[model samples]
Target: MADEETKAELREQFTEAFEGADYPVSNPMDLVPALPDGPGTRFEAGDVSFTAMELSTKLSDIQDFPYDDVETLVDDLIVGLDEKDML
Candidate 1:
């Protein structure tokens, strides 16, 4: 399992990734096509569609941190999606 520190780091990264104007203040789902495949699922934001795997990868690439806390990461991701109006 991932430690609390790892989970927190992921959360911070997620928040950063979803911030800013070019980041699509609305939803990207309405922009992109369909998702590939992975855990969680696919979501839409305005014009962008993001697969669970894609989102995970983006978060992973943001920081050098590691997290074995799948649940925590998933939960934070869901919240991030909603925050970005993708849910």
Candidate 2:
């Protein structure tokens, strides 16, 4: 299990990495982190949900993640993570 400090660092890196990108959605989903308490991180938009760690791995593995838009990025991330059973 990851320690609090490690999780915090990962969370920070994850947030910064995503926020740094250009989200096409005018009102992108809000990042709802479940840190220091809950299971993991999630992004909420209407009835949709996103897992941060899965997204992070998806991004980190890419030479440079192509999508600049959050909508597409999250959509692809979910599919990829799900296929890998990481979601």
Candidate 3:
């Protein structure tokens, strides 16, 4: 199990990764043809998993890519993972 400090560091890394990573932000309709069938935007940061669709929506709503709800979710997921001793 990761300690609180480790979890904090991991969460910071997750937020940085989200902010730095470049995803194809296009119209949902336009993206259909761009992405192959069954292909997904699943990312793992430490013990947390994120999907592109959810992130996209949150990013749009927040007007701050890689912040807001994404950060909260990442924090919660990290805490949960730590509690479960999965990190």
Most accurate candidate by TM-score: 3
Mark the regions of model 3 whose C-alpha exceeds 4 Å error after superposition.
20-68
Candidate 1 segments whose C-alpha is farther than 4 A from its true place: 1-49, 53-65
lDDT accuracy of residue 19 in candidate 3: 38
- In order, how many clashes per candidate? 16, 0, 0
Whole-model Cα lDDT of every candidate shown, in order:
0.43, 0.43, 0.46
Q: How do all models score by TM-score?
A: 0.32, 0.34, 0.39
Q: Which of candidates 2 and 3 is the stronger one according to lDDT?
A: 3
List clashing residue pairs in candidate 2: none
lDDT, candidate 2, at 41: 54
Tell me how candidate 1 scores on lDDT. 0.43
Candidate order by TM-score, decreasing, is: 3, 2, 1
Q: Per-residue alpha-carbon lDDT of model 3 for 1-87, expressed as tens digits?
A: 655666676677545544332343233333323333312555444455555454444344333223334465456546555555546
lDDT of 1 by residue, 23-64 (tens): 222233321222233244554443456655676566543322
Clashing pairs in 3: none
Per-residue accuracy of model 2 over 1-87 as CA lDDT, tens digit each: 334454344444444445544443232232333132122555443333445544555545532345555445545554554455443
Angstrom error of the Cα, residue 44, model 3: value is: 11
Give the CA lDDT, 0 to 100, for residue 51 in model 3: 55
